[model samples]
Target: MAFEKGGENAYDVVIIGAGISGINFGYRLQERNPDLSYIILDGRHEMGGTWSLFQYPGIRSDSDLYTFGFPWRPWTEETSIAGGPLILNYLKESAQMYGIDKKILFHHQVNAANYSSEHKTWSFDVTANKTEKKTFRSKFVLLCTGYYDYHEPLKTVIPGIDDFKGKVIHPQFWPKDLDYANKNVVIVGSGATSVTVVPAMSRTASHVTMLQRSPSYILSTPSEDALERFIRRWFPVYYQHKLIRWKWIAVPFLLVTFCQYFPSLGKKMFRSATEPQLPPTVSYSPNFTPDYNPFEQRVCFCPDADFYRALRSGKASVETGVIEKVTADSVKLTSGKELHPDIIVTATGLKVRVGGGIDVSVDGKPYNVPEKYVWKGVMLQDLPNAAFVIGYVDASWTLGADATAQMICRMLNQMKKEGVDEIIPRLSDKEKNTMKDAPLLRLKSTYVKKGKDVLPKAADRGQWQARSYYWKDYLLAHYGDIKSSIEWNRS
Candidate 1:
């Protein structure tokens, strides 16, 4: 069945967010169930999601493009690490090439979604362009909203930040007219954003100082993959792409595995790789060393060692200390060291907002996500015909998203075969009481810890367990018993 246009606001499937996850799911739907009518609704004016939203200097993918890019549409670029504009273009091109672009409705924000048990359908309250209200209906709803809050970043209260005379900027809302040419800049974080911004801003600014309370694991990787290039030269395009993508996926999986099991060895490996990249003046301890083990928090990656190069050139530097207060002209550290800057960039972390902050209810009763356990890391327990995509923390997000897309498609097909109107993951009261509670996200990062209350709950056993491995999840999605712990209904 083809989707009706004009006044029609109904679909067999409605996917919220035209981001990477939504686009991938749309393709899977077309491939797996061509007769199903579907549409992708995005709140933003553009379709690139994060790539389109973030306009910070030197914005780029921390993960390699080979794995980050869609599985069907391979990233053929020479460079594995890519800039924002390049990635945005790739997404747009892939969407257009696959006819996914035509299936999207931009500027349509889904505010609330309610499931009607009697009707076996979902009704969405939507706001168009921040004003016009509309309603849409679907048999199945997929939230591909990603994890973070788009409107607000994670709040960090810097002591007396109001006293700072210089311009304070957050990377999320970078201004186009803001100029920092030959100006002193201080970036207040040691994460990926800060690492990226320091190097890029150093090119034009008089000086850039990355101020961090503590250091994070930072590794430098080659911009281009020589092995991929060699494979491209010898193999057919199909095999070449497959080989390259698998290589990227397998290597990261192995690395994350090693880090998780042999944390000491992983720390050693990271320290060895990072120590050589630092300048003579900077010591490995305090400045480069992290208190936690590698992958405990995500390891920051610097392509072609751009960050190190900036530091070596004396254009940028790293400072490790606690902020005491901010004076009119400078930031006062507890150690008595003061930094005077014309611009302060708060490259702090992101705020997690699951389901895009959409109010979800079933039969007019509000559903609390954090209280509910996730079934198969895709669907929530007791939620009928609904799923949300939360990607892998250890590997590429697309890998997990693809796994989810395939799994959801399988469920939809099964429903058709069984002649069921609705499918829900359910647990008996005894089983729910006996199951142990676990966190949905495995990371111990500050943002993850802070946003624990906003995320879905998990259990330690069976289908209730949170996502751990891509291959394991992939196998489960394909061949695992879909009937396990699930209930089917006809309305």
Candidate 2:
């Protein structure tokens, strides 16, 4: 069923991705006003977004389950920090329980959406079910479509990959029935995907070799417990936001602060703390560099679970080396070591593609997403009647999106109350000139940037602007309002 193209009716709002972000956007709006008309569209055959496509072994979220799950629905005792399948089931369950499944059109890939100035409606051309092509129209379109692709495996060149006789696969598109029970596996990359595979395959595979370009500092924390809940309830929303913000700030702040305050003494004290954590056999190298701080890029891993279990069992090993080439049955490393493997998993990380690889244009002029400054990281200054939901990376995905959705809902309510039919975030020329992106290495989101502005600035590192502190942001957003936080418009 197409939107307006269905002849008689069109939803007031249409969400492009059915993942947690899009689904929450729908739920939040519906809860705010049950009469609000909307439908969610996903490219996959099912409702789960990333959780559905990434079927690799031991695929589970790095974040805690408490806030990561959903806004209205707490991850009850039966469901918690889950694997891919469990999360996918949760999405399905949410869709079913919310009565969103009927409205969600699966396997419907939205190719492009154009906003009409005169009509103030979005015209969308979508490839549905990979067979029939059609167009749908809506008053507003939410690009909830996340960074990952559903149709194919991300391509990576390993030189002699074609010559390798063993089966090869990307973590995003693993073959379900492929047997690796007694296989020797060599997985490339040290990102989240690689961390998951190391422990999972260890249970069946004879051995799993992990290769990485450089060593990333790893840390762990408990998923959920009484202490966190107490913190959630004990502090006022604003105070809690301040505390978490300071917590994020304290890491690099203390380092940068002490170094400047007591140059000599602080330098000595810094080494005393960090040096003990380095592997005893490996000497400390000043080259250990993190542009911002230890947890800057995203810190997710089960504390003393999969990653720890794999290391303790000696079934999984880590090596800092690049892949030089691939052979018929082995991979050649830059260090001249040869690894013969039965399966090679390219956990090399996912490529970020915003707008589902569809180009965004305004008045026939092509515009890049990063070229514009992100207003509260949701509204693009120059876009009218539009908002995209962003997920939590360090904290909880649902929490971040929930706040974004709330703010947008507030904007919509304000617009209606004030007789306004439009709202747009217009960028100032100076703001655009100073516009900077968060660096690619330190960011895992779909948007790309040249410098540090892409991630939340250190000065703005609290619940509203910080990237890693999930609980802080989740709580703040749940109670926050966008109408108060955002600059809007009226008719």
Candidate 3:
């Protein structure tokens, strides 16, 4: 099971970061084109990506399992929103079922990739377990590294944080032995992570307080889908799964579209759904209300309204204020209030690293990653025989991953048929000038806003643009003409 270092590796394709996106892409590539030789590499010694990295208590999918699960895999669990351990197990099961685990090289961290125009191959410099360095060569390089930095969690600099005496933690690097039972815990930030951890920690923590600068719109759903359960009882398993998957997928798409086009109406409906869950003393206007419209930022999902129940039962509370300073025993707020806590969980945000923080060059020149436009939402502009799988922000991450796989497989198969060695996506001069500039990711989440500039750009329209809608992306990936945006060359 141990992947040893010191050998020079070569393959038809080299996939970096064997996470959800990487595993899905590798599985599809191997399934579609059996003749192609590929290897999946990860810095971590496991197959599951985010699922493996995150170990915070009560950590579950922000989205439902039906949509979050891979298209090829049927999520047979009764709960639609599964915890981290279950998700990790599902990913591992997927790897074993598709034989992707055998093709994966664990502890292989990609440092840089250099593409040669004349040789038509990518050369990689990789480090294994931070000790041994080795070279790898492949006809193409596929990056499936998720956006967040795995080596270090994004830590925010709070004034006087060094003076704090309490145990501080980031959800990304939750300690295995740190116990919080019967302790006062103050969780910073109002994102999905904060909401999730608040309800979970309140169960044992003497008091859990969620401190936020601004509120994220929170919604709740049943952990297990009753309709899905009913369908499973009456229908064939495969048919039921497919039906539930498509239904869940479509509902999100419709919700996103509705919010996008009708912001006011969407906001009103969101507040209505949230109001009944709040305690009588708590107002939904300021703390629970968001200034941004729905889908601009992702709506936080609290399964079965446990977060609300926790708040109502006085186990946890929410505070909206900026942190002025952190003292030895408490955190001072701008509103002239101080919070005393035994523990502080700074779920501030994630630090986004484009292309897995790996340097990329083309023919001895540094590749300008942020300057390139997305080609059909998957491949970067002017990048030859390379693609990076980034999933949907609006839907499940795997939805975009699956679409990217389908598109890449089609492109690869076409190149094989035409005897082409390189395929590069190019934006015409007119296309570049005519197109309007937009952020690489449409979501206005805190983590995204902080790291948007370093990421790639997207055009206003056409095949070169990026979209979060799964149905549209799925159709384009399967049926869109590859010749329109890319130039195929034999050299």
Model 3, residue 124: distance off in Å is 0.9
Tens-place lDDT digits, model 3, residues 1-491: 01122335878889998888888888898789788888888888887888888889898898888888887888988777889899989989998998999999998888889999988888899998889998998888889998878877776888998899989899999999989999999999998899899999999999999998989989888866678778888998769989888888888889888999999999889988998998886778678888889988878898899999999989899888899999999999999999999999999988988788898999979999888899888899888889987787778888888898898988888888888889899988788778898767878887888787778888778777776578778888888778987888875
Error of 3 at 182 (Å): 1.4
Candidate with maximal TM-score: 1
Tens digit per residue, CA lDDT, model 2, 49-93: 888767788888765554566746555432234687777787778
> What clash pairs does model 2 have?
381-425, 381-426, 395-470, 420-491, 437-454, 438-454
For model 1, how does the per-residue alpha-carbon lDDT over 227-259 read when each residue is reduced to its tens digit?
Answer: 877998899987987888889989988998899
- The stretch of ten residues in a row with the least summed lDDT in candidate 3 is 1-10
Rank order (by TM-score, best first): 1, 3, 2
Best by lDDT: 1
Candidate 3 global TM-score: 0.96
**Candidate number that wins on lDDT, 1 or 2:** 1
Q: List candidate 2 segments past 4 Å from native.
A: 1-9, 78-80, 152-157, 221-292, 359-367, 429-491
Per-candidate TM-score against the hidden true structure: 0.97, 0.78, 0.96
